[model samples]
Target: MMCDLETGICGPAGEGNSEMELIDLTAPTKKIDLYYVTDPICSHCWALEPTLRKFLEEYGQYINLHTLMGGLLEKWDGFADVSNGISGPGDVAGHWREVGDHTRMPIDGSFWFEDPVTSSYIPSRVYKVVQQKDASLAPVFLRKAREAVFPFNKNISNDQLLIDIVNSIGLNGEEIVKESHLPAAQESLQEDFIMAGRLGVRGFPTIIFLNEEQKGVKVVGARPYDNYVQALKQILPEENIQPKAINTLQHVLQKEGLLFSREIEELYNLAQQDVAAFVEKELAADSYIVEEVLGEKYIQLNQ
Candidate 1:
């Protein structure tokens, strides 16, 4: 089974749903490993940011998370399998608009119309290179890639754009560009692709939760917060499962230097009808974070 976050729906990626199976409750206790298979340009993967952040925050102590790149779109030349015969950027842009409506995630579909990406390989390779340089910086760089494509309308496939992202993250852009072509980077990406194939992954944002015995419980799709909690409980029933309450805005601001209103809403499980207004009010009162609008309204810690 696969979960496409872009459509906020869980279904078989292709052919059959044979991969979906119940976790073995009798499995021995061991450290959980979460392999997050996703593509940079996958709108559903972008939509999963909040759920991912919450997952890491709550179960980080009990689980080890590994992000693997799933090459979603290799090329657009012969790609016509998407809904409504997606042949060009215009069709993809329309799909992104629909995803934004469904997930309530900030997505400026203008990227496809303004500066369309021909392939997802370039950014995926760049991610591998970043991981090679400094493994910790990988997540930040991935977020930058998403921001560039979805909100800023930048072509991440371009070398210059990739360089800009590297520099923006305080990394050695020149070194990254210089070694981006190294065989190791390509090998790392290939390994991810091979592993994805072995795991029967066919969609974006497919999270596989594995135990010490390598037994896995797959969570497919952009599901609600409860789905993730339930999956974790099923996998590691012996471990304490307390989801920390994000009771204050300061907690979020201090942890993540930058903040989005939607992120806060999802992180806190806020039931407020107008999450934007609530976030705006919080930002207005906070003396620590300064708000800015870059396609979407966001807050950064006042440095």
Candidate 2:
């Protein structure tokens, strides 16, 4: 089966639903090991950013999150995702627009029309190289890559844009770009693909939770906030997991640096109608910079 646009499940044509793996954790460091399998260009993965951020903020103390790239599109060879009603790359434009509208995230989806990406492998490999260089920088680089493609209409498969993103994170963009072309980067991405296959993963935004006993549970798709919280609770029922309130924009932006109005709305517990007013207040009162993109407001802390 092809990818389902409604569920935001992007995978190969014939992969099954993800089943939790019982891999042996050799003296697991944390109470839970979270393998976050996602794609840089996956629409649902982009949608999961807000909820995923809250999950990490609230329960990050008890979990060790490992990001694994799920190979989504590898040179779309006349490929059509029948399940999602996408005939080609041009079809993705409208679908992603709808996704942005529903999720309240700032996604432009115009890249598919302006300059469509041929393969996700290039950017994914760049991320793998970044992951190899510095695990901390990889997340930021990936986020920028997503922001580039989804909202900014950047073709991340290109080397120059990828280099710019690396430089933004205070890393040596030239050195990293040079290494991303090597075989090792591809190998690292391949390893992730093998693991995803072993786990029977069928889409992007698949989170696998494993406890000390090596027992695992899978949470698939861009689900509601409670679905993620409950998944963590299921694995660590014995331990007390009090979800920290997502009450501060400064705290969240300190790490992420950039956030959209809807993202702040979700984290701040504001109603959809109040999103504009809340973001406007934050900008006008506290002196934050808001960048408008595709009819959405993105607040960024002054650097």
lDDT of each: 0.77, 0.84
Candidate 2 residue spans exceeding 4 A from truth: 1-30, 245-247, 273-286
In the range 10-120, model 1's lDDT, one tens digit per residue, is 876754444466775533345688889999889988888888888777667667888999987788888775555687877888787778667766677776876788788
Q: Which ten residues in a row have the lowest lDDT in candidate 2?
A: 20-29
Looking at model 1, the pairs that clash are 3-221, 5-44, 6-44
Clashes of 1: 3
Q: Write model 2 residue lDDT over 173-274, tens digit each, in one string.
A: 888888888999889899999988877788888999999888988999999999988988899887767766665676677789898877876787787678
Candidate with maximal lDDT: 2
Backbone clash tally (model 2) = 0
Clashes of each: 3, 0
